[model samples]
Target: MTVLILGGTSEAVALDQLLADQAPEIRAVVSLAGHTSDPKPLNLPVRVGGFGGIEGLRHYLIENRVVAVVDATHPFAAIMPFHAEAACKAENVPLIAIRRESWKPRPGDRWRSVPDISAAVETLGKPPRRVFLTVGRLELPAFADAPQHHYLVRVIEPIGDRLPLNGVKVIQQRGPFEADEEEDLMRREGIEILVSKNSGGPATVGKLTAARRLGLPVIMVERPPKPDVATVDHIDQVLPWLVAQGIFVTERGV
Candidate 1:
């Protein structure tokens, strides 16, 4: 049974690496959304971009003979898994989600939870404060209502257009950033408030830690609800499932 991995997160990459090394005989392909300007290389053969929609995905699955699916998209990705679930159900193929757990507020963290990006902006209030905007480029526009605040946006690439905030500085960096680095950035930029989506993972939690140390209040956007489906938090758990499908043969080499 060929496995299709809906990839774009670290968990997806881990699963791909495991499959490449342990289940080489299993024909597996990773699918990337290609939203990032530059994404890291993965071990498995990857197909980039969307599959048109539910029908397009159904057609691709039927055409490629995909027997099973593993959905390991970013936590904030609310649409792709929905499409995967619909397509897999229609095709009668088993599907499982591999989601990384989100971050919980620690003892020192001063977190104010918001339902969405717009709510987070509202929580920031009328005062013009220097903000560390860690929610990503797509969510940046939500701050248009509060443009008086200075923003230090950390992104994989520049927005390449007019920013919603009048006072802004963009930092181009990739994870995993260290705690010391995060502290330095906050201090250098004189950030007073931290805004972030609780994208649960180790690769990008340094800002939260730094905020805690500096006693800065964080506007944490809660993660959206995920679709109901079989899910796993670890990579190795999928091996048994693959074996159950009679697909994890011991063929060597990638």
Candidate 2:
């Protein structure tokens, strides 16, 4: 039997390794959205680019004889989850969403949670303050409203001349970032405020730790709605789901 993993996040990468090691019999094929120019390759066989949409995904599941799907995309990549559920249902394939735990406000974490990007823009307010914008390459147009603030944007790809904010610096990098490094970057930049989506993973969660330590006010954009599906927080949970579906003979020591 085969399993499809919709991957772009670190959890997805980790899950790929776990499945390869634990469930050797099940052929696991990972699908990437191909939004980024270069995505870190996984050890397991991977296919880049989209599945065309819901119809394409459904067809892929049926054609591939997929036994299960694990939606391990970003928390804010909302639309994909709905499509995963639909495709799985149509193909009679079991689906599990590998959703990471959301970042909660820890002690000294001054968070101003906003409904969406527009609200986050409003919460950022006016009059120039150095800002650390960790929201990535999504809707940067919203930040153009608060252009007065000196913005330091972190993205996986180069934003180039297309960034909407006037005074801005872009860091083309990915993470597994050290908390000390994050704190130092925030300190050296003279950042007074932090703007980020609640991506909720250890890779980018260092920013939250830095914000709390620095006592900076964080304008956190809340996550979009995810489809109501069987969701698991950790990659290990996927092993059990595969076993439950009779895809795997038994769970190996993980």
Q: Which candidate is the best by lDDT?
A: 1
Q: Estimate each model's TM-score.
A: 0.95, 0.94
Candidate 2, residues 1-254, lDDT tens digits: the string is: 57899999989889888877866777999988887888886778888887889999998988888888999998889788999988888878899998888889998999999989999878877778898888877667778877788988889987755566567888888887888899999999999999989888778888888889989999989899999999899998888877788777673522
RMSD of each: 2.4, 1.9
lDDT of each: 0.87, 0.86
lDDT of 1 by residue, 31-80 (tens): 99888867788888889999999999999899999999999899999899
Runs off by more than 4 Å, candidate 2: 251-254
Model 1 has an lDDT value of: 0.87
Which residue segments of model 1 deviate by more than 4 Å? Answer: 162-164, 249-254
Candidate 2 least-lDDT 10 residues:
245-254
